[model samples]
Target: MRAGGNIEITDLMRFGHLAAAVFAGWILIAPSIDCARRGLQRETPLSEWEHMDTFTTQQGCESYRATVIEAEKADSKNLYNARYAYSLCVRDDDPRIKGE
Candidate 1:
């Protein structure tokens, strides 16, 4: 019998392999977990802007503008126009609204 009761060499090897697999999995997933944490942090403040119907990134605001413009060009009336206008109104208000 081993020091830990009946744990043999094979059992120790299996435990080592399991530990290594778990470590590797954590390494692979760590970056994504960090990215999600950062994304959440960035999004939390932007939620306040959401209530005012605005975007937190230039790309987002520009995309909204383009959609509205396209809708107008097609002579299609929709809510995108108002959203684009609102985005424009708040575009320069938050400098931290760069991007992710």
Candidate 2:
């Protein structure tokens, strides 16, 4: 069978394909735009916490401490990054730039 010329599609199939395309586009673009707007940036990988001393001993105790540390570190990094991005956005958009 030949490919890449033209394929037949029913009306329902065409609508379904269009809906899927739109849904996929929104799934891809919405989070990124929200991230840019709110500065919900990605944090550095901290999987090393799993192998740290505090976590390498007792499995349960270690897992708890590791989770706490990892969460705190992630929170810290997120706050700093978000503030930095917000400051940048604010600087660009501030009306005080006109020297009023």
Candidate 3:
């Protein structure tokens, strides 16, 4: 204790160390806590049935769409056909569309 019963240098140092430890613990666990909270809040997966496919050209996307259609036609009960029936191609270079 200081002459006036105030906190001494050692006490300050101890408090600083404790604060540092708490801060470090929070940093380590913050992400996990946030992820857990998000998991609880999420009722379903972000994209349960939809997926984005990137292709170098429009023809590639068309080809994939055709393939998906054929696969659907081959088996109406196929899950892929039901999920991707209205598949459309967007040009990567098109300014109106966003690219990933």
Clashing pairs in 2: none
Q: Write the per-residue lDDT of candidate 2 for residues 1-43, one digit (tens) a residue.
A: 2356656466558988787645431000001214455643234
For residue 86, model 1's alpha carbon misses the true position, in angstroms, by 12
lDDT at 57, model 2? 23
List residue ranges in candidate 3 displaced over 4 A: 1-49, 93-100
Model 2 residue 19 lDDT?
Answer: 76
Using TM-score as the measure, the top candidate is 3
- lDDT (Cα, tens digit) per residue for candidate 3, span 11-79: 889999897655431000000112444322122332221335666556667777778778678787654
Please identify model 2 stretches exceeding 4 Å from their true place.
1-9, 23-100
Candidates in descending lDDT order: 3, 1, 2
TM-scores for all candidates? 0.27, 0.19, 0.38
1 versus 2: better lDDT goes to: 1
- TM-score head-to-head 2 vs 3, winner: 3
